[model samples]
Target: MSRFLPLTIRFADGGSMVVSSIADAKKALNGVWKDKEAPDYLAATRLVDDAVAGTCRPAVAFAAFKKAAAQQGLLKPADPSPALTMLDDLWSRKGKGPPG
Candidate 1:
């Protein structure tokens, strides 16, 4: 079985989704990474590294991708976000509702 990393995403307007593995998270981020700088593959790699190493929260991985893209001047800075909001929210909401 594949080892999974739990991750969450919250939109600027308050919508959110949770992904259970790095693979899924990559797919989700790719949807946004295409319009930015540096190949989406590269950004995805860096984001995975940052997430696994804990230098970046799994959710902030997206922000890091945005930052890297902006540094290359291929895209503008993404909006500010709460650090690791996805993971944080997921953990916080655990066991409080009906099973999925």
Candidate 2:
């Protein structure tokens, strides 16, 4: 009933980071915060906002997400897409395949 998420983090100051999900990492890096110091999420959100505003580069924000994923040690390795399951079922054709 539970799922595991892979994530990572990267820091500009060479610090460490942690997160639970890709969305969580993104939010941690980029979401707003009341504290001016800006936690990882807030900082990331700011970077993404600047990129969206055309004030910063897209790579900057993208790297932030990657870094966050790394720091959290949650990055998932390359795996086949879930859609492959459907393809397998279709190919097997227990009922849907061409009639003999």
Summing lDDT over every window of 10 consecutive residues in candidate 2, give the lowest-scoring window: 1-10
TM-scores of the models, in the given order?
0.29, 0.38
Residue 9 of model 2, lDDT score: 37
lDDT of each: 0.53, 0.52
* Model 1 vs truth, CA RMSD: 12.1
Candidate 2 deviant stretches above 4 angstroms: 1-38, 79-100
Give the Cα error of residue 47 in candidate 1, in Å: 7.2
Q: What's the CA RMSD for each of the models?
A: 12.1, 10.3
**What's the lDDT of the predicted structure labeled candidate 2?**
0.52
In model 1, which range of ten residues has the least summed lDDT?
Answer: 69-78
Most lDDT-accurate candidate: 1
What is candidate 2's lDDT per residue for 32-83, written digit by digit as tens?
2233353654566677677667887666765665554444444445456679
